[model samples]
Structures are given as structure tokens and as C-alpha cells.
Target: MRTHLKNDIPKFDIVHSHSLYLFHSLVTGHYCRKHGVPYIVRPHGTLDPFMYKRHRLRKMVMELLFENKNIKEAAALHYTAAEEMTLAEPVTFNAPGFVVPNGLNVSEYDHLPKNGTFRKKYPELNGKKIILFFSRINFKKGLDILIGAFDLVQQQHQDAVLVITGPDNEGFGDKVREWIGERNLTDKVIFTGMLTGEDKLAVLRDADVFALPSYSENFGIAVVEAMACGVPVVISDKINIWREVESNRAGKVSSCDHVQFAKEINALLANEELRSIIGNNAQHMVRDYYQWDKIGMALEREYTNILRTRERRPQSFKVRGDASV
Candidate 1:
């Protein structure tokens, strides 16, 4: 899928590519343009200023050569959040946009074991209040900040244990472990490498609080998953969905500062009633807003609108190099 597009590329009403950088999407976009099929571009948070600021010169050159054209020619820009739409609009100009959040199959939360499925496997976590950090172990995801905050959290709450689990990214996991050893926090923190399937869900279900102090996030599907499991989340304010979590009373949002991060973690870990109250609110919000039924309908409506409009005003479809409106 990453290399040449097979001659058997399936016929479709629309060609939707989720990115501009990934080579497969570039091939797919060029193919669609050649075939007169409209394509949709969804940045999935990559268009945010945080990412745009990382490699300005190279990115600007690429945008001028490829990404800019791909985006400008897209039928519509698909954003999971309104903020994403706002961040992406200038790049797309008159290209339309629609918002439909990523959602979970709420039914999956129905029969998860409520008890300590993870604690039973790792008995050391049996008595400790588990604070789970499950995501890519990378700096941008803010694992370093989380470790510093967890070190502080231990001073206030000795019973708390932090579990850092995820795939290593940019060799940051090794750095996190080294930091832990230097701080002599090996006893307070556990690095579980990577987990998936039942292992992932088990920890999320059993953890007392879920934390992802990311520097930037688009939708935060993991936060929503934690909320669906009735586990409250403590996330960074830069997360795009912090407003929803804050408004829903489902989680705590703090800036990337480890001081404030530790404070929120301590508050949730210290109060059982508070955890339960926010956990309940989190579950309700997931059911009410983040469910597949609600989000899928909105998504399907966009698909319908695109296809309907394409058929209605076939002239609206423009060629690849058609710069004219």
C-alpha cells in the first residue's frame, strides 16, 4: 500500500486520504486526480501550529511542491474537531470541511471486567493506586513531563504507582527509564513496554486514573476510551478535546507544567469520591457524545452530502491542475 498503487485499485465515489506526508496518500491523491475522482484530506492534528513549527523550511518547500496542491484540490477537508477545521481552513481556502469526531463502539465497554484484571497479573500493583500512562512513549506525547510529575506525586501519595506503557518512539522510552533510575524512582514506576488487546483494556479498566499530558492532540481517542471505562483522565490543556472533557466534567486538564500536572494527578488519586464522581460523568459523556451511533451518523451524512453534491453539480469537480474556480 505504501509503494505503487496496484492497477486493481477499487472503484469508489470518493478517494479519502488521511494525510499529506504519507507516500500512499500522495499516490492515492494523484490517482484520484487523474481519474477525476474527488479526494478528502484529514490532517488529524498534523496541521496544528505545534507540528507546523517543527521543520519550517523543509515543510514549507514540500507544501509548495506537493501538500499545498493536494490540499487546495481536495473536495473537502475533514476535521474531527472544529479547532482542527479552524487550524486547517487557511490552507484549503474554498475547499469545504465537515466535523465528525472519532468514536468508540460503546458496546465494547459493556462487559469489561470491573475488577483488577491487571493487578491479578502484576501482583505488585495489587495494593497500589494505579496511574496509567498508555500511548506512544514519545516526548511530544509528554512522557518526560509525566515522569517528573509522577516523582512529585509520590512525595504526596506514597501509595500511588505509575505505570508507563507503550511502544518506544524516537528512543524516548529509554530516556524515560534512565530518568527514573537517576531519580531512584524504579520502585515507584513500572515500564510495561507495550500492551495491546486484552492487556491494554485490562489496565485501562483497572487503573485508578489515566494520564496523557500531551503537548498537542487532535481528538484524544485514548482519553475517551479511559472515560468510557469510568476511569477519569488528567490531560494537558493543549489537547484539542480538553474543552469537551472539561465541560463534561469528565477529566482534569492542566498545562504541560509538571507542577500543575502533579497537582491534578494527586487530587484525583487522593479522593475516591472525586474519582467516582468524575468517572461517572466521564462514562455519561462518552455514551452521550462519543458513541459510534452518534458520530457515525454525522460521518455518513457528510459522505451522503459529498456524493449527492457530486452528482448534482458534476461540474463542481475540478481537474488536478485546474487552478481556476
Candidate 2:
């Protein structure tokens, strides 16, 4: 990969590195600097306060060694959401930054599967109002809060079931299960491990509402996916895209507190009319803002601006006289 970058990087007008704290990005920054090419770094939530707390020592070491330099020297920083940029302010050192959200292939959601497909597979979910949470089961995903909220949800609507579908890549699933057990919600919550392709879509189609109360998310792609499928969402403000959701009236935004989260969930669960309205709003918002074609254009414009700005700047160093400086 380094070899490929070394050869091909000079061929491009500018470089865009996707994540921080990596050898590839470090090397890319070095090459970009060496070649006098401007590069943009997208931290992808690594600079979020919550992330810094998780692996403090290692990240601190990386930042002090090369990461900070890599960030400081970059021509621009790309953040997926405005909230991400705001949160990263302290670390970014007021670097030039812009917000362009992650997008989806709108075509993939053009036609949804039969609504009952997922329920047919899981007989227990047959006659229940489903609240779906579709993302990796991780500590940062706020599953503990979701469970606490679901416990309250079940009290109001016994017929409602919480469906969690995603890979437990972080080994946090057991802890989530323990939370569910403590709340006496073992039966009310269903963990389908991971669902993909049609299976994933089927569940999305069957869902009454999609919920992701993440503790901190730079951009919740799964939340967007649910919105694309015309499913109303209940997400926490901590998820950086909450502003888009709330402003567009596409979904409900709640505080990270479980009680408030449960209130938002219950509101959606109680009113089928309100759910349909928000669901339609969600679909419209995705089409208008989260489509790949639209995002591509926005990104292209950012690249163009960067190149144009670089062209306008005078060189910091130049060869002069016999010294070749």
C-alpha cells in the first residue's frame, strides 16, 4: 500500500487521507509534504473526546510523535459532521476544516423487501411492534442506555420488542446481555447477531422505529440507512448527525439519559400517524442530503477549493543562487 501511494500520490493534484493514527496516513502526509502537495485528513471520529478517553496513553503517544504533526501540516481537515468538527476543535488546533457527511447509494433502498420477511424468520417477533437497533454492538454504541430505555418502553407497551442486529466485534455483547437481564428484559430484547443484504433490509422494512442512542458517533451510517428506508429514528444528540435529523423533522433526538431516550421511543411507538409522518420526512432527508451523487459533488467542490487556494499561496521555500535554496 505504501509503495502504491509513493508511486501514485504524485499523479494526483491533492491527497485525502481517511483516518488518523495509521502508518498509511503518516506515510501519505510525509509524501504529500515532500512533493509539495496539499493533503486533507479526515479523523473519522478518532479525535472525539470519547475516543481519547478509551485509549489515552497510546493515542497521546501517537499524537505527540507524528499524529499531531500530520494534522498540523495538512492543508485541510475533513469532518463528516459539523458536531464532529466542533468536538475536535481542541485537538485540531483550529486547522482548516469542512463538513461533508457520509452518504448512501439511494438505489439500494429503492424497493424494500416484504414487511413480514424478518418476522417470519423470528416467530417471537411476530406480533410485536419492533424497535430496531442496527449497528455493531460496542461500548460506545450506548447499548446499556438503550437497554435501560427499553425496560421503560416495555412497561408502557408490552407488545413492543427491541431487536438488536449487528456483529459483536468488540466483545461488548455479553455486557449488553447482562444489562438486559438486570432489567428483566431477556424476552423483550432479541439479538440476531448480524444481518446483511436482504436479511438486513427485511428487518429494516419490518421495523416500527429505528433507534440509535449512541454515546458518541461521528456519523451514524446505520441511522441514515434506517432513515433511507423511511423508518423514523430516535437517536441521541451525541450522534453528530442529530442536527440533520432534528432539523429535517426526520426523527426524534434525545439526551443520552435513558429516561429521556425512553420518552422519545415511547412517543414514536404510541402514534402510528406520527411515525408515518417522520418516516416520510426521514426518507426525504436521506434523498436530499445523504445520496452519494450529492455528497460526491460537495466533496469535489472542497477539493477544488483546496487546490485553488494552494495555487494562490506563495512557496515557503525556493531555490536561490548557487546554493540551490
In lDDT terms, which candidate is top? 2
Note each model's CA RMSD in angstroms. 4.7, 5.8
Q: Write out the backbone clash pairs for model 1.
A: none
How well is each residue in 18-108 modelled by candidate 1, as lDDT tens digits?
7666666666667777777767788878788787677888778877767878887888888887777777666666678888888998898
True-vs-predicted CA distance for residue 244, candidate 2, Å: 1.1
**Regions of candidate 2 where Cα sits further than 4 Å from its true position:** 312-325
Worst 10 residues of 1 by lDDT: 316-325
Candidate with top TM-score is 2
